[model samples]
Target: MVRAGLMRIARLRVTLAYGAMLLVVTSALATLDPLARERIVEKASTNLHNLAHGHFGTLLGSAFVVDAGAIAVWLPNLLCLLALAELLWGSTRLVVAFMVGHVGATLLVAAGLIAAVKEGWTSTDITRATDVGVSYGAMAVLGAMTAALPRRWQALWIGWWIGVGAAVVATGGDFTDAGHGLALVLGALVATRFGAPEPWTRWRLGMLAVASWFGFAMVVSTTAALVPATSCGLLCALVGGLASRLSALRTRPTPSATDMVPDFERHALS
Candidate 1:
């Protein structure tokens, strides 16, 4: 079981590396003085000011940083979605999905904002909004994942995604919301290239890994609370172990009928 789990983890090379990179950057950011961290984060923002100045590098740089306060949530979120995409589509394809979703949507949003401001539709303060995080890329991967669902569920999932995004845009949500929405759309379009979902059984390991991670995270979070809380980490670990073992068993070559005979009977007769 342990070996199987390790092997499964090893297959997620791109996902783990990206997560580690984020962790390194975030840990370094946390060590800085609060004001210094804020300044760096502001500079990394892909907001209108940065975009207008043609600091296009922020488009790539901003994905590597997150607000100190948001690291916990965004890190896990990035891992699960991005890892699944990597597992399903391989490293190169995952990179393609992330870049398309992140860079494409960001540019689109900036263009919209530029047009909006020029037409006297909004305040200039918006240009300075902080827009650093991996969520746009995350959303793109998430949107593309719709391809993995059953057909009925796929339609429902896509509708819910787009409906929620459009609703947010209509109600005057932050420009980031629009970026997120556009990323999802772009990701879904990318999914068209991938066509049908992979086999259902192929995802068992992914579900097991995701469940174990979330369960462990939940236990850690809940245990740190004001009062005692349920710790399901043990349960999750058990489930993951069982799942890993079962997967190994299923893949083991079947014994021939002659080889299946009781060892004692076969030896005694001989």
Candidate 2:
């Protein structure tokens, strides 16, 4: 799995790296004027109202544009997670999973938000929210990558994602969080058809670490009187460390059976 991820990174170095480079440049340009930047973000946003008008350019373009603060964070996530999915499921299938998650979650969340607006649950207009970022795609890739990992790693990886995501949303529920949660679920569902997980060979220390962190976060969220921000930060740190350690582990690359069709004629001839 590690070698395969590395190979995918090599294959995507030019595409994703240059794309990240361009995002940095665009982000700098957007920062020059506060109003202009706001307008750009607004237009690039995939809004509930905007979707009704058949505006899909935002779906693809938003992936390329992000706030200056988030550009630093998302660039690495996009490269690492997407590359891993690309290697495991092939670039075409990975792209499909990403788009499926992106569009599906966006539409689903938009519908929910529109319903909220109609029901007067939120005074904030759904049409004006700055909902622009690569988060949807990133979550999708992470979800799909979970299916490609060994079961031990899969449980931990997927668990941390769900736990942290649910904790954050439970504390600060928002449209973006809803979109992220939906994307993860959608990605996992679609990816099952494209790839299978590796068998578990032993106890998964990673799973324990993730479960402990998740339990801590849940306990903090419910039992403690700590500020939400502080608790979330500590939880994020724990999960981030676990993810980094997982990234650094060396795992033997196994061939994906589902990704390749068997050659019956060649086998017969042999």
Provide the lowest-lDDT 10-residue window in model 2.
Answer: 215-224
Give me the displacement of residue 126 in model 1, in angstroms. Answer: 1.9
* Best model number under lDDT: 1
Error of 2 at 107 (Å): 0.5
Q: For candidate 2, write residues 183-257 as lDDT tens digits.
A: 887888888888554333233334333433432332234332235545554566567557656766756465676
- Which candidate number has the best TM-score? 1
- Residue 154, model 1, lDDT: 56
Candidate 2 pairs with clashing backbones:
none
Candidate 1 accuracy as TM-score: 0.71
Give per-model TM-scores: 0.71, 0.65
